[model samples]
Target chain A: MLEARVYVIMKPGVLDPQGKAVKSALDSLGFEGLKDVRVGKYFAIKLDDISKEKAMERLKGMCEKLLANPVIEDYKIEILDIKS
Target chain B: MLEARVYVIMKPGVLDPQGKAVKSALDSLGFEGLKDVRVGKYFAIKLDDISKEKAMERLKGMCEKLLANPVIEDYKIEILDIKS
Candidate 1:
């Protein structure tokens, strides 16, 4: 089995209201000097018995197909761990 | 400067409706063999000239203060990079 972790974030120029909301909350809670709190998405996937290379290829296809919005978001994937 | 990345996810027993929505969408898009899609939150914070230790202290405080709901969510933080 392999573990894949994916992170998806808004494009640099895009507005992130969710992040803004969290930042404001942090400010209210006395967290000073924190700025640009962009919020993103994280996904963990456990794949069945597949070679690492094949898994990566299929996972990237998954990201492009549904995990992220290519127009307004960018994503990164990390292979966290693999165990047989 | 330091780059801090924090990820927050629902507790194991907690319901993740957002994740379910995404999984259903993936199914509709013909993604087979995908199950248990749990969604989480990611945060990136760029900090000013502060020692790494101090930055970590402050960032953890930020996470507990407002970045995550301790009641239903668990968070992990990564110090991505630090530069002077």
Candidate 2:
């Protein structure tokens, strides 16, 4: 089976409270050098009989339509081998 | 600035309702060749002066403690260049 790794993140200028909380937690934990952090969603999609080219097309369509909210989030998709 | 990409996914055999919901949506949309789908959380963490080794350690600690549920999810962390 082939796999697609889809990453969906909030737009650069958007506020991310979850990420901010994480950074604050890191600060309280005494970890240093943290500049910023952003949180997002990842989806690993398994396909049985699709070619890589077609899979890419379909995955992009999936993102633009359902997996991501284009008004606030940007998404990326990566094709991966079966073992992943 | 260095960055880290952390991917957190449910372990194999762990029930995933979100993925199932997505798969069903795809099915309804007339897309085929899908075997399975898994959903996860991805974090892009930026650091100013931390080395790759140390960043990894801290990120892993963060994952085990807060970013992920150690009992049900597995996470992978990647060090990234600043531009990423």
Candidate 3:
């Protein structure tokens, strides 16, 4: 068994409206001195009996094909654990 | 300056339709041997001149109030860095 974690985040130059909204909401709620807030997606996946290198390759494929929008978003993949 | 990361995840028994959809998509795309998938929200926040303990407390309050739905989700906060 293998577990991997993926984080899909917006590129630095991209404008994140959702993140902006959250920042506004936080300001309204009195949590002051907030410099910035960026929101992203995280995924935890479980796969059956795969080697780490193989799983990383597959996970990147998954991200490129479906999980992330390559134009504006970038993703990071980490193999969390492998349990036999 | 303080930087923090928050992961807001669904409770263990909670239904995650988005994750299920992703799993099905991955399967169709030929990434097989999939067991499970879980999707969550990740937040990277920057704040001005706050101690780690105070920031953690405030971050928790933010999670409870806005970042997560307390009934169905749980949140973990990590202070990534503090720069004076």
Best by lDDT: 3
Candidate 2 segments exceeding 4 Å error: none
Per-residue CA lDDT of candidate 1, range B22-62, in tens? 87887788766665678898998776667778888998888
Quick one: best DockQ, which candidate? 3
DockQ of each model vs. true complex: 0.66, 0.84, 0.91
Give the docking tier of candidate 3: high
| Cα misplacement distance, residue A65 of candidate 3 (Å) | 0.4
TM-score of each: 0.88, 0.91, 0.96
The interface root-mean-square deviations, each candidate in sequence, come to: 1.6, 1.0, 0.6
Candidate 2 local lDDT, A1-84, one digit each (tens):
787899999999999999999889877887778899899999999888678898999998889888999999999989987663
A1-84 per-residue lDDT for model 1 (tens digits): 667888999999899998888888877887777756889999977666667788788778888998999889999988766545
The clash number for model 2 is 0
Output the better candidate (1/3) by TM-score: 3
> Local error of candidate 1 at A44, Å?
1.3
Tens-place lDDT digits, model 2, residues B1-84: 888899999999999999999999988888888899899999999887677888889888988888899999999999986663
Q: Per-model C-alpha lDDT, please?
A: 0.83, 0.89, 0.91
Instruction: Give the alpha carbon lDDT tens digit for every residue of A51-84 in model 3.
Output: 7889888998999999999899989998875546
Give me the chain B TM-score of candidate 3. 0.94
lDDT, candidate 3, equals 0.91
